[model samples]
Structure formats: structure tokens, C-alpha cells
Target chain A: MKSAQRTTRRPLALAVAALVGLPLALSACGTSTAASSSEAVTEISVMDYYNNEPDKSFIGDALTKCGTQAGVTIKRETVPGKSLISKVLQQSSSKTLPDVLMLDNPDLQQIAATGALAPLSDFKISTDNFAEGVLSAGTYKDKVYGLAPTVNTIALFYNKDILDKAGVTPPTTWDELKAAAAKLTAGEQYGLAFNANPTYEGTWQFLPVMWSNGGDEKKIDTKETEQALQLWTDLVKSGSVSSSALNWTQADVKDQFMAGKAAMMVNGPWQIPALDKQPTLQYGVVKIPVREAGQTSVAPLGGEVWTVPQTGNKARQAKAAEVIACLNSDENQMSMAKVRNTIPSKTTLAEKFAAENPKLATFTELIKTARARTGELGADWPAQATKIYTAIQTALTGNASPADALKQAQGQ
Target chain B: MSLTTDLSQTAAPSSGKASRKHGRPAGPPTEAQAPRRRTRQRRERIFQWLFLVPAVVYMALFFGYPVVKNVVMSFQDYTTATFFTGEAPWVGLANYVTVLSSSLFSTSLLNTALFTIGSILGQFVIGLALAIFFQRKFPLNGILRSLLLLPWLLPLIVSSAVWRWILDKDSGALNRFLGDLGVINTGVPWLTSTSLALIAVVGVNIWIGIPFNLTILYGGLQEIPDELYEAGSLDGATGWKAFRHITWPMLRPVVSVVLVLGVVYTLKVLDIILGLTNGGPANSTQTIATQSYDLSFHEFKFGEGAALGNVLVIISLVFAVLYLRASRRAVDE
Candidate 1:
């Protein structure tokens, strides 16, 4: 009986031992393969957040083209927009970061501050001729860590038929905008729609108005900022803009505009393709309205920047830098800009891009004066952005007066 | 003799000695035989324990590790950089302090309580009514009962998205139908108004939870034998009186289980609220779970998020303990 029991226990112990050993053995095999492969990386991996189409295919083509230029076969990976940073952080901890990484421009500083990215200067990559806003966005501690080929900013997109029918011109100043919006308001449709949801996107939309009104982010409680908040509150209070603007995303705003429930919207050039899909929806783009006649529309710059992450693989890092450079070359920038409905980040290509794509002339001009969200606060922008959006929500929801909302949010 | 007498003789030597003292028939155990018998019993106990090993290992791997890690994380200053640097400096109770003392904490707590209570009450009351309604022998009752589960079958996110369109202020089907009936002059701002967002979110959540409650309660109702009802009728205890005495008392166990499970599930509900309102319109619908996610993912404040998450866990644990006690008392009675 003892001999038979020992036999049974031995097999059970062996099975438990195997179950414990399997994960360890598999992880060991994984690290060994990675170590061996990193020694001579013929194919460097690239990761980005272009998970949607047209932009995905466009970026894919550019990456493949750049990979050929760098003499490396590219292994591209794409995650959804929201999960890219989380994926990067996960890879960072595991010491298995991709050779090439794409970060939304405002996110570059936060990621670079983690010491996970190699400065472009390390690989002798040129950082010349890029627009100042985008350059500032990709810079951390005065070191250029990433580069964007094309950039975009929000502008006032209006339905031509609605404006024409209402005999209202595209508003150029805050006062003009208010009057035009109020005049255009009719049954079952609001005069304007813009996102003021309690999110960073809401903060982004409000920046153009706030900055144009001389509302500095550094001191958000100032009268100038209050004026911007009051503008949104007034629009909602006047019933010219939907109270539902508090819940609409930029996409939702676009949908309302297309559905004729909204005559104008604050949106980016990315909506051009979707707008073109509806042939009867004639729309015109202009700079986001200014506070006064001479005040510039300093819209927040929006774009994705490519960087070479510090993956401890010198060969792959060098190759990734080459791909980054090739992607930012004027020719590739112009091509990508055309396909993605964005303007090249290099100011020198503005005239050429504008002449080639006349419909985006307003955006081309707007890009020159666009401001980077992180230009002032660096890694601290998210905190300030949260404050801005909270204030927007408080004011828009009528929970507080504009001045009181700013005061309360700034306290936070 | 029998196996019982033989086992007693070998296994319980002291008892056998006592029996001998009382002048009963007993075989005295030899020294070598006693040790061998002890070993055999020990081996059998080990065999019985082996059957539970898989479950114990699974719980340790999945539940134990995460709970321990989350507790450890709540005491540290974990952030995005910590993921890369692996240097989570100890901050003691600072994370908990920040989370508890924040301005939004009170709002989020109130919202969480309201959301859970509102959802459970709505789901249970409506579910019980439907379950009782279906107890009758109507035509196509089985098919109709099965069809009622369609809402629960669809994914929460898909339902949330569908509900979002249906609840839109202007172009929504709900407003359109209301307008056709001349209910109001203008569209009701369902999800966009601070006053109405929470109620709208709760309505959608109730819709999602009804099917689950109905199914469980229906099963419990089916388990109660019909003879009790027949006897209650003989005593003139029909209709509401029968339900009060016969059905309610017997259904307490299942009802407690359903309500406790519902509260637990509703307390952790993030996806439906996120997909529908995203805790927007001035954070009117911002529950503790959504706020925790916002802290961890949006603000990258994992430590504070874990601290808030632990608070939710403790709340759920309190409910779970109360449930266990209630169910035990019911069994005793």
C-alpha cells in the first residue's frame, strides 16, 4: 500500500512541478530569443496609434518607404488612440520597447520626461526647418526627442448653404461670431456646436477661443479667460448653441453639423474626408474667430510625432532615427499632408501645400500661428488642461458663473 | 466481524481499550500495526486534500496576487514614470488622504450610492413583477420568457451605444416618439443636462439589469413547489396573502442572493456608464468606479486610484458579509 501511494504522490508532485516550471521556462526562452535578436536587428519594430483607415494606410506606406531608405524591414504595430501610451509604458517597464514609437505631440513631453526616448541629436538627426509649435511639442528639457511631419489645428467649419440662406458671413471676431450664430439659430437646429465635455478635447477646443482672447493658460483666473468662458456660457444661454454641447465629442459635433442640426462647428481638418463623403454638404473652413480684429487665432497644434525610443539596441535605434528623418523629409511630408488632410509642419512647404490644396488654405494659414499645448507647461499640461475643461463644464452647465467657475477650477 | 468493528479496533486504540475496560469484545493493537494504520489514514487525508489543490492555486494566482499588489500600490507613489523606472517611493497613507479629501470625492460617493441603490431597486421590483406575471400558464409562455433575455445577451457597450443614439436630445427616437405623441414642445436633454444625466444613466442601467434579475428570480420561483400555494388557498390565503406568506418566505434566500450580487455588480459598473455618458455634463454621473479609472488612466495616478478602488472593495465586502449572515439566519429559521 505504501509503495502504491508513493507512486501516485510522485506523479502528482511531478505534475505540480511542471505546472510551476512552464511559465518560467517560457519566459526564459522569450528573453533569450529577444537578446539574441537584438544583437543584429535587420528589422526594427515601429508602433503608432493610427489604428483607423486612410491615415493608417498612409502612415504604413510612409513607414515602409522610410524603412527602405534606412535599409531595414519595418515591423509596424498600431494600437487604438487611447491605449498607445499605456502600451508604451508597459513596454517600457518590460525593457522591450519598440525601436520606433509615435506619440501625439502633447504626449511627447510626458513620455520623454520618463527617460524612455533617445534624443534625435544622439543619432545625428537634423531638427531644422520644423514649425516652432511642433518642435516645442516634441522637445523636453531643451532636447529634441521627436519630430512631426504634418500638423493640424481646429478651425471654424461652417455649412455654406445655411450661412448663405441666413445671409450671414463666416465670423471673424468674437462679437461677429456671437451675432452670426444668434442670427443663424432657427427651428430644430442650433447656430453652432462645439464640444465642452469634461475632457481634454473640450480643453483643446476652448484653447483657440481662450488664447485668441488673450487668456493665458498660466493664469487662468484672469479676466481674459473669464471673457472666453463667458462667450461659451452666453452662447448656451442665448440658445444659439445646444446645451448638449456639454456632451458632444468633436465627432458628435460633426455628425450634428452634417445632420443640419448645427450650422457651424469648431473642428479640425481631419473631418474633411467625412465631409466630402456627403456631396451635398457644402462647407467652408476659416480660422477660429479672434477676440478682436487684430488678435491672432492661436489654435492648439494637433499632430503625432515619431521618435526613437531608448530600447538599448544601438543598431535598431540608428535605423529608427533614419526612418524618422525620412518620414519628416519635405517630399514625404507634402505627400502625407495631402493624404491626411493636414498641413506640413515645415513652414517652407506651406505655400506649395496651400496652392496644391486650395480648400485647406485657411488651415495652412492657421498652422503658422498655431500653439503647442505643452509649449508652456511641458509635462504639467495635463493638469492645466483638466482645470480648463472643468471650468468649461461648470460654466456651460450653468452650475456657476464664468468668473466663479474659473476661480473654482483654478483653485483645483 | 464487520468493517466498522475492524476499523475501530485498528484506528481507535484508546477507545478500544476503554471498551475492554467496560468488558466489551476488543482486539488489542500491536505497535507496528498502529503506526501502519496511522500512515494509511494520513495518506487518505492527503488524497482528499489533493482534489482542492487546483482551486486553491487558481484563487491564489488570480485573486490573492492582485489584491496584495493593489494594497501595496496604494501605499506608494505609482505613476507613469514608475512603470519605466520601477521606483515607487513609499508615500504611506498620502494616496488615501488625497483621494478621500479631494473635492470630487463626496460627489463621486453620492453618485455611486445613488446609482447602485437606484439600479438595484428598479431592477428587483420590475424583475419580481415580471417573474410573477410569467408564472401563469399563458400561451407561448416559454418562448416569451426566453425572448425576455435578449437584452442581457447583448454586450453592455453595444447596448450603451444604441441607447446613446436613442436618447439623443434632438434626433433621438425617444424624443421623436414623444414629440409625435405631443408630450412636449422641445426635445428633452436626456444625457446632456446635469439634472437629467444621472437619471438617464440609471434608466439605461436598469434596462440592462432587468433581464438578469428576472432570470434568477424566475428560477427561484420555479423551485417553490405548488402544493404550498394550493394549501394556502385552502386556508383562504390567495393572491397577495399567498405571496406574502408562502412565496416571500421561501424566496428569501434567492432574493438575498440576487440583491447582494446585484449590488456588487452595480458598484463596479464602469463600462456602461463610460460608454453612455463618460461621467460628463459637469460630472453629474461620475461614480466612484469611473473616477477611479479616470485617476489611473487619465491622470496616471495609479496609487490614488488603487486607494479609491480599495474603498469600493471594502464597501462590497461589507455587503457580502451581511449577505452571508442573512442567508445563514434564513437557513436556521
Candidate 2:
């Protein structure tokens, strides 16, 4: 009986070992070797979060072209946008960071603060000719750590057919926007749609409204910010904008506009491809309205900046920096901006881009005056972003007045 | 007897050869046999423990290590910079204080309790009714029972995505169906309203959990002897009376098992709520699990996130201990 039980138990123990040991053994096999000065570098790895179509292929082709120019093969990895930062931190601790890394503009300062990226000046890369906001977004502590080839910002998108039927041109100021939105409201259709969900996207959408009104992220509980919050509250309260906007994402707002449920939407130029697909939908772009007629509209900048991560491989890092510079060349930037519907980071290229692509002219104009979200707060931007979105949600849900909501969030 | 002889031989091959050469008899024990027998038993005990080594090591590597690491992380000032600099100063309960004292903590804790209790109650009552109905004689009962398992089989993320469209305010199927019936004029903000989001999330969880509860309860129902029901009928205990007296008493063990497992599973439900409302419209559906994820991933406050995660684990541990006690008592009865 003992011998028989031993035979049966031996297999069970072996099965358990195989089940647990296989993953451990496979994970242990991932040891990587960085190129030493003694050996010539041959391949460089790149990582980004453009895991979706069109942009994925577009970025892939650019990387391939640049890799050829830099005399190295590129091994690129794409992850979901939401998981990119965590993945970077994981790779950083493991000493397996990719050679070239792409980060969203606002996230640059946080990662750079970790000392995981090499400054572009280390390679003597020229940073001149880039727009002020573009350059500021890539700089951490007066050192440029990354550079974006193209940049974009949010603008107002209106359905031409619906607006024409309503006999209303696009509004240029806050009061006019409110009046137009109210007049355009009708059965089963909201006049305007934008995101106010309790997330960073909500904060991004609210930035233009706040900043254009001279509200500062540093001091959010002020009359300037409260007036901006009041405008958002008024839109939802007057039945012109849907209260569901508190839960809608930018993508959802775009869907509402395309379906004719919303006559106007606050969106970005990246949504142009989807809007262009509907031939029946004649949409026109304009700058987001300012508080008063003469005030300059200040939208938040949006784009990804490419950097060379500190991988302890000087040879490979140099090659990676060259690839980044190639990606940001004037010729590559212009062609990329045209294909991706973004404005070039360099002001000179942006003028040619706007003239060539009339559809993105408003976005190009908005990018010139756009403010980087992290320009003032640096790595501390996320905490302020959370407070802003919380205030927006509270005011929109009728839980508190705009002034009290800001006060409550600020007090926390 | 031969088994003992075989064990002794394997334990001491040199002594076995000497005895075999001398052609010693097996059964009658001399003075030397006592010591040899003791050594053989010791060897057997060692062999038995050797079989458990693999399982113990596996548990330590996978389960024990992570739990210890999480507890350690909760007390340190780990952040994005810690990944590179490897410098996490000992903050000592600061994370716990911040996480527990924050305004959202009370809301999330209450939401977690409401979500768990609401999901389990709805799932159990409806599931028990369906199981008892299916227990009766009916045609196509086997196929119908298998068909009910569809909701339990699909991935939670996929189900939540489909349900999001169905619960949408303006264009959802539920609103359209209700409008046709003149139930209401405007669409109900099922997932958007602060007052209703938690209920909507609980309702979805209950839908997903029903199949699991039904399958387990049905098996428990099958284990019960039919003679009890027959005897109860002769005693004039039929239908509801029969269930109350016979089925209910027999099914207690299964009920406790199902309820404990359901509570543990429902406490960590993050994907469904995240996919639907994302703790939005004023954070009406933010459970502890989702809040922990938001802290770690969204806010990048790893230390506070770990503290919140440990709090959840403590809650689950309490339920686990209760389950073990209940199961032990059930065995005794």
C-alpha cells in the first residue's frame, strides 16, 4: 500500500513542479546583454504606445526609415496607452529599458525626474526652431530630454449641415457660445458635447476653458477658475448640454456628434480620420471659444515626444539619438504632420503644413498659442489634474456649486 | 509482513545482504530486529515528507512571496523615482493614515460592502429559485440547464462592454424598449447618476454570478435523497412545506459554501465597474479594489496603493477564516 501511494504521489508532486516551475524557468530566460564598447552595436529597441492602427503603421514606417539612416536595425514594441508608464517603470527597475522611448508630453517630466532618460543635449542635438510650448513640454530642469516631431491641440468641431439648418455660425466667445448652444438644442439632440468624466481626459478638456479665462493651475480656487467652472455648470444646467457629459469620454462625445445627437463638440484633430469617414457629415473646425472676444484661446498641447533612455550603452544610445533626430527632421516632420493631421513642432514647418492641409488649419493655429499642461507644475501636474476633474464632476452632478466645488477640492 | 521485510531491505541494503546470505527466517524477531525495524520506519517517514517538498516550495515562491512584498511595500515611500534610485525611505504608517483618513476612503468602503451584499443577495435568492424549479421533472431540462451557463462562460470584460451599450442613456436597448412601453419619456441615467450607478453595477454582477450559484446549488439538490421528499409528502409536507423542512435542512452545508465563495469573489470585482462607469459621475461606484488600482496605476502612488490593497486582503482573510470555521462545523454535524 505504501509503495503504491508513493508511485501516485510522485506524479502529483512532479505535476505541481512542472506547473509552477515552467513560468519561473521561462521568465528567468529573459536576461539581456547591452552592447559594450568592445563590440559593435547592431540592433536597437524602441517602445511606444501607438498600439492602434494608422498611427501604429505611420510611426512604424518612420522608425524603419530612420533606423536605416542610423545604420541599425530597430526592434519596436507597442503597448496600450494606459499601460505604457507602468511598463516603463518595470523595465527601468529591471535594467532592460528600451533604447528609444516615446512618452506623452505631460508625462515627460515625471519620467525624466526618475533620471531614466538622457538629455538630448548629450548628443549635441539642436533644439532650436521648435515652438515654445513644444520645447517647454520636453524640457525638465532646463534640460531637453525629448523632442516631438509633430504636436496637436484641441479645437471646436461643428457639424456644418446642422449649424446651417439652425442658421448659426460658430461662436467666438463664451457668451456667444452659450447663446448658440441654447438655440441649437432640440428634441433628442444636445447642442454641444464634451467630456467631463472623472479622469485626466476630463482635466484636459477643461484646461482650454480655464486657461483661456486666465485661471492658473497653481491657484485653482479663485474667481477666474470659478467663472470657468460656472460656464461648464451653466451649459449642463440649461439643458443645452447633456448631463451625461459628466460620464462621457472624448470618444463618446465624438460619437454623439457624428450621430447628430450633438451639433458641436470640443475635440482634437486626431479625430479627423473618423469624422472624414462619414461623407454625409460636413464638419468644420474652429478654435475653442475664449471668455471675451479679444482674448487669445489657450488650449492644452497634446502629442508624444521621443527620447533616448539611459540603457548603459553609449554606442547604442548614440544611435538611438540619431534615430530620434532623423524622426524630427524638417522633411520627416512635414510629411508626418501631413499624413497624421498634426501641426509640426517647428513654427516654419507648421505654416507650410497649414497651407497644404486646410482641414487642420484651425488646429495648427491653436497649437501656436497652446500651453503645455506640465509647464508650470512639472512632475506635480497629476495631483492638480485630479483636483480639477473632481471639481468638474461635483459641479456637473449638482452635488455642489462651482465655487464650493473648487473650494472643497482645493481644501483637500 | 513481507512489506516490512521489503522496507528494511531498501533502508539498509548491506544488512539485508548479510541476513539473506545467512538464510534467516522473517517473522520471529531477535534482539537486532527491534533496532532494524525502527530505522526502517524512520526512512519511510522521511520519504513521505519528501513528497510534500515541491508543493511547499511552490506556495512559498508564488503566494507567500507576493503577500510579504505587498505588506513591505505599504510601509515604504515607494514611487516612480524609487524604481530608478532604489531609495524608499521608511514612512511608517503615513500611507495608511492618508489612505484611511481621506474622504474617498469611507465612500469606497461603504461601496464595497453594499456591492458585495447586494450582489450576493440578488444572486442567491434568484439562483435558488431557478435551481429548485429545474429540480422538478421537465423536458429538455439538461439542455436548458447548460444554456443557463452562458453568462458565466463569457469573459467579464466582454460582458461589461456589451452591457455598457445596453445601459447607455440615449441609445441603449433598455431605454428604447422602455420608451415603447410608455414606461418613461426620457432615458434613465442608469450608469451616469450618482444615486443609481452602484445599483446598476450590482445588478450586472448579480447577472454574472447567478449561473455559478445555480450550478452549485443544483448539484447540492441532486445529492439529497428522494426518499426524504417521499416520506415528507406522506406526512403532508409538500411544496413550500417540503422545501422548508427537508430541502432546506439538507442544503445548509452547500449554502454556506456558496455564500462564502460568492462574497470573496464579489469583493474584488473591478473590471465590470471600471468598464461601465469607471467610478465616475462623482465616484458613486468606487469600490476599494478599483480605488487601489486607481492609486497604483493612475495616480502612481504605489505606497498608498499597497496599503489599500492590504486592507482589502484583511477583509478577505476574515471571510476566509469564517468559511473554514463554518466548513469544520458542517463536517462535525
- lDDT by residue for model 1 (A261-369), tens: 8999999999999999999999999898888898888889999999998877777788899899999999999999999999999999999999999988999898888
Over B154-175, each residue of candidate 2 has an lDDT whose tens digit, in order, gives 9999999888888888888888
Q: How many steric clashes does model 1 contain?
A: 0
TM for candidate 2 is 0.92
lDDT for model 2, please: 0.89
Alpha carbon lDDT at B18, candidate 2: 52
- What tens digits encode model 2's per-residue C-alpha lDDT throughout A152-172? 999899999999999999999
lDDT of each: 0.88, 0.89
User: iRMS value of model 1?
Assistant: 7.6
Each model's DockQ?
Answer: 0.28, 0.33
Which stretches in model 2 have alpha-carbon errors above 4 Å?
A1-35, B1-46
TM-score of chain A of each: 0.91, 0.92
Top DockQ model = 2
TM-score of each: 0.91, 0.92
RMSD list, candidates in order: 5.9, 4.6
Candidate 1 residue B171 C-alpha distance from true site, Å: 1.2
